[model samples]
Target: MEYVEIARAESERGELVLRERRDENAPTVLELRANGVFVMDTLETSTEQALASAALALVDRPRAVVVGGLGLGFTMHEVLADHRVEKCAVVEIEPRLVDWMRDGTVPHGPALLADERVTVVVADIAVALAEAPPSSYDLVLLDVDNGPGYLVHRTNAALYREPFLRAARSVLRPGGALAVWSADQAPELRDTLAEVFGDAEAQSHDVVLQDREEAFWLYVARVPSDA
Candidate 1:
């Protein structure tokens, strides 16, 4: 395996160390870390993309969306591909990841960062969630942790709890959609969604990264209409 030194940068939070490792026979790996905690990379983003798309697909009039994670802009890119998406608010926890994407260290470079509909918020996603009015969005996609179980950051576990899920529903229009991507299927998360949203479904997809495979599931919940 050939390892490439990428960059060591700083965000509003702490230092971020990035690296690219390429195996002789496998796909190139882009690794990211914030204050020494490992974040997401270029391994597999199928579920990420699906998280955004699934939310959109559930809403017939989805004009605006808030994506909680901006890991490689794969989910944002997928959302923008839809003509119906008029606005997108991407909230990223780490500011350094935005710099890495802008500086071309993350492969796609300026092309990914220069999109018109995107508004980058270099703050906690919960900040945006706190400020958004009720029924303001048609869709909400969260990729904060590895799902509800394996949190990349300990603080993120709260975002997966029932209260946060209801908060997600609070900002979405009646019958609007909420989609979440997880590394593994979380039954407890599913049950929480069921209790809060009234209608919940799970969709699974297989992700292949560096010849290693894993199954990812996107939990989708829809706010029910009284009618």
Candidate 2:
């Protein structure tokens, strides 16, 4: 199978590449890459879906959601699947990524961008989280990089640290949940979430790829209603 380059852009974080690959056994797959590293592909998005579903399940009537990273819009789309979600704020650091999605360069682009309840912010997620008012959202889902261990850019390491987690927590309403999607299990991250949220659990999702079965992780933490 041959992968054709769909588009490329020099993003602030790194070089962003979008490509399409076709296989005889599967439908056309769109892939998103950053700094020459594979971010995600449209073929299988269970981890992203689980990131939204699992988090929303922990919150009651989640009216507002903050999603960090807009990879192919899978996470955002899954969040919008729930009718209870009145506002879905997505923060993407790469402006070109948003442009590609809005311009139909990506398959899942237009619908997500056109959703009335969805707001796409072309800014760093950390900045967005820092500027968010306290108790503003019902949920915060992050899948900015593969995980804290596999960041496309070294600077993104801050997102998975103690301070960033604290910032994310401050933006969530009482009893709101924070969920993060990781390509692999990170016990350290789970530990950090526990330290910040008082409690945290890691949910593992089994995913079947073309050649093998793999697992992803979703770390979830909830704010105390009294806090």
Candidate 3:
């Protein structure tokens, strides 16, 4: 098991590194690290895919979607897989990572971004949500950090709070849903979602990775149909 560094960049926040792992017996894996912390990889993308699927299921007509993060593009990829999705807006804070994806540093990136339904916005999701047109999206899927409990950046904690949740809700069309992915069981996050969306549910999933079985959670809430 060895990792070969493919690309690296330093941002004001921290360093972003992309590495490739190759084993004669296994498929090549692309790993993304932010500030020297593990972010995500191409090996096991089920969790990300599940996040998109579950969120999309909650909306009766999921024509527009906002993805809060674009790590490796797995989540967005899944969102595009649904033909019902006509527009996908991806807000990513890391410009370098976005460049890598556009420049073919990430193999699957160009194809995913080439989708006519996709739009990439390089900015903080908070700012993006703040500036978005009201009732513009049918679904808002956030995977910016690992979760509220496991944050790669301290400031992302604001995302799980009422103020930010309110902004997320404001951008959703009536009956639209918002979903957040967390690496840990975030009871507090579920509670916050409930507070903001009136009612929320948390779904637990067991993902069997190459090394171990990890538990992931998805917190989901929907706006009232009449609202």
Identify the runs in model 2 with alpha carbons over 4 angstroms from their true place: 24-26
Number of backbone collisions per candidate: 0, 0, 0
Minimum summed lDDT over a 10-residue window in model 1 is located at: 9-18
Which regions of candidate 1 deviate over 4 angstroms?
10-15, 22-29, 34-38, 225-227
Deviating ranges (above 4 Å) for candidate 3? none
Count backbone clashes in candidate 3. Answer: 0
Question: What range of 10 consecutive residues in model 3 has the weakest lDDT sum?
Answer: 204-213
lDDT of 2 by residue, 61-98 (tens): 79999999988999899999999999999998889889
Summed over model 1, clashes come to 0
Model 3 Cα lDDT, one tens digit per residue, 44-115: 888898888888888989999999999999999999999999999999999998999999999888999999
Which structure among the candidates has the greatest lDDT?
Answer: 3
1-227: candidate 1 lDDT, tens digit per residue: 88776988764456778888799898888877666777767776666666777678888977989989887788888988999998899898787778878888787857866888888887787777877899888899997777877776678888878878878888998778888888788988888899888868888877776577878888989876541
On the 0 to 100 scale, the lDDT of residue 200 in model 1 is 86
The models' CA-based lDDT, in order, is: 0.81, 0.89, 0.92
TM-score of 1: 0.86
TM-score of each: 0.86, 0.95, 0.96
